[model samples]
Target chain A: MNEVADLMVVLMAMTNLILLGTARLTLGVRLVGAQGALAGAYMFAANAEHPTVHVLALSALIIVAKGLVFPKVLLRTLEKAEARHEMEPYVPYSASILLGMVMLASSVWVSSRLPIAGLTIPPSAVPISIWTMFTGLFLVVARRAALTQVFGYLVLENGIYVFGAAIAGEMPFLVEMGALLDVFVAVFVMGVAVFHISREFEHMDTDRLSVLRD
Target chain B: MTMYEYSCLPVVFGLTLAPFFLGIINRTKAKVAGRQGQPLLQAYFDLWKLLHKGAVYSRTTTGIFILGPVVGLAAIVAVLGLTPFAGCPPLFSFIGDLILFAGLLGVMRFATMIAALDTGSSFEGMGASREAWFSSLAEPVLWLSFAVLARLTGQFSLGAIQSEIGSALWAASAPELALTALSLFAVFLAENARIPVDDPNTHLELTMIHEVMVLDHSGPDFAFIQYAAALKHWVLASLLAGVIAPVHTGHAWIDITAALLTMAGIAVATGLVESVMARLRLTRVPQLLVGAGALGVMAFIVDIMR
Candidate 1:
């Protein structure tokens, strides 16, 4: 069970690196979806010894929402926004990937220093979750497309979900479901905003939005 | 005494069968393109024909132009002797042979690039510069991969590392091993001038990386370069195959056969990739190499945490 969970986390880390390196917005969306699905699988594997209705339901819900529904929403947003790739990012894709490596190392360092109290999670769970969060935030800051930023936000939420699942023993069912609902709502709102922004401005690059200030 | 004699099998196999794998690659590509490919012995025939031809040299050319192919071939042969095949020990192994392995590759590249520059041709110079830049990015990834393997197996030498990597270590850290294998595959393609990094078949000098560097060579010198390249491909493929499919049957023949098959599989995969995907833009090549390095770094960190 622990090995399965560890493998899932490592795979999620790989998806995060691929996300950092990819320029195609649609591919990035799909990779995030896959990352979300893996997080759900991680939840299931982490609690395989004693299955609970709530745990199984939450994992299935996560898989459906983040993995299936979120990518659909993001891809639709991408189509409407008329963005194919995230060109001219604040950091180049290569440098962003290297930064991602740095972020992962730091996450490992930080997790090793700060151990979770009373939690018997897989050893790789904490650092990978933290790294996922860092990669998400990095994507948000580094990419120019508003749609890509939404993918970043989705990834950030997935990281939180993973961290929650890592400590599922202590996390409340209501809290977890509420967090998912909030993310779903947030994504819907962001998609609408991105669509409107692209329609009004004729491009989805948030970097150029400051031209409206004058 | 028999064990020492048996260890020489990889060297012998590399000397004779390296070009055959290139033949496999071409045939795979041909099959995918719906054509009756050249015979499986096409590479051998080319080598033989070139070896029998007379040499040609330009009036402005110096001795270094002739020296490049010879030195590059020598370095690759030495590297092949250091490479372990299918968990079998190499003919030569030492405490820091991994460094020697990577350095010989660098030496081969340096020799080729200088020879290209010696011709005073602008086209080969461009190719050399591109090769130098991309390889500088790639070399660190190779070192990082070696670092991961060394850390995992607690060995400094390639032979010891290859021998230590069995089902047990893979069971312990499969993710790191897989990631390292992926990075090595990228290095192999990049180093060998394969598709996605480079297209070996590209005739345009403006687009060629490795081929353009050898445009000045003719006859036996070109044959040496081609043979050296085939051997280099085999050497790198052996490294990757050692990591990906380390079949330990406790029988030398079975292990050797399995390793050879794995190499053939890699060649076919390469051909398929070349057929399916166009070469990346020149500007994007560094990004691809850097992305490979990032994978290597991730593997190293993950192994450390494990």
Candidate 2:
């Protein structure tokens, strides 16, 4: 069981590296969806010994909200914005990938230093989740596309959920449901904001969105 | 599988099989383009024809012009002697012989570049400059790959390193091995002047890297250069094969055969790549080479972590 979870965590890290190197906004969104799906699978696999009805229900909700709904909204945002590729990135794609490896190494080092007690999953799980969250923030900060930033936010949420699932076997059902609803509403609002920005500016490069600063 | 320490096998195998790789690649490319390709023995025939022809020299050139092909051919053949095939050891091995192998390749490149400059032809000079620049970036990637293997196997010589990476190492550190193989593949493609980095068939001298430097040579000199080019490709492919597909059948002869087949498969793969993808922009070539360096670095990191 631990072996299966370890494989999933490694795969999620690989997907994060791919996301950092990818140039197409659409492909990045799809990879994020796949990562979300893997996170849901991790939840199911980690609680294999005793999967309660609430745990199963929460996993389903995660898969639907993260793997399906968020990506669809982002893809529609991409279509409406007419932005297929990310241009004028803050850093080169290759450099971002190297940076991601660096981030992964640092996360591993940091995870080793901070010992966790009563951990349900592998000790590496927390680091993997932290690394995924760091990668998401990197995408949000480095990419110029607004849709990519939204995808990054979703990845950040997925990492938080992974941490929650690994440490606390099951959160309260109402709290989990509330968290899911909040994510959906946040993505919904972000999608609308992206639609309006594209309509007003005729392009989706958020790097140039600082004209009103003066 | 038992390791056999031997000599003379790589020399005999290299001389016989090097030209066949070129033939296989050309035929594969031709068949892919819907043309009736030349026979698999076409490269052998071309080498024969060139060997018998009279040589020509320009009045502006010096003795180094004649010395280039000879030195290049000897260096390549020497590198071949230093490489191990299958599970058998190389004809020669030393504690730091891998470094010597790299140095010999550098000498070959230096010989060719100086010879190109000796012609006083601006076009050859341009090719030489490009070759020097790209190789400066590529050489480190090659060494970094060697460093990873050396660190993993705890051996500095090529023969020992190749012999050390048995099934146990593969099972233990598969990711690092895969990364090293990828880095070596990139180095092989760049070093051989293959498509994506260079187009051997492109007649436009302005775009040529390896071929342009030899434009002034003809007859026997040209033949030496051509043979040396094939041998260099063979040697590099052998090195790559040793990493990516190390065959250990417990018999030296069978292992040698498996290694040879693996190299032929690589030739076919290269032809397929050429058929599907266009050459990268010259400016983008460094990025690809640097990506290879990145793979080497990642492999080193993975090895350390393991």
Highest lDDT: which candidate? 1
Estimated TM-score for each candidate = 0.98, 0.85
Q: Candidate 2 has which clashing residue pairs, if any?
A: none
| TM-score (C-alpha) between model 1 and the true structure | 0.98
Error of 2 at B303 (Å): 2.6
The residue-by-residue lDDT of candidate 1 on B83-199, one tens digit each, is 999777899999999999999999999999999999989999999999999899889989989999999999999988988898998999999999999999999999999999999
Give per-residue lDDT, candidate 2, residue A145: 80
Give me the candidate number with maximum DockQ.
Answer: 1
lDDT of 2 by residue, A49-110 (tens): 78888878878878887889888988888888887788868988768877877887787777
TM-score of chain B of each: 0.98, 0.97
Query: What's model 2's lDDT at B272?
Result: 89
Instruction: State each model's C-alpha RMSD to the native.
Output: 1.4, 3.7
Reference-based lDDT, residue B28, model 1: 95
Residue lDDT tens for model 2, B1-306: 235444567777889999999998998898899988999999889989999999899999999999999999999888988988776788888999999999999999998999999999999999999999889988999999999999999999998899888788887676678778888988988999998899999999899898899999999999999999999889988888888888776877788888888998999988888888888778767767777776787667555543
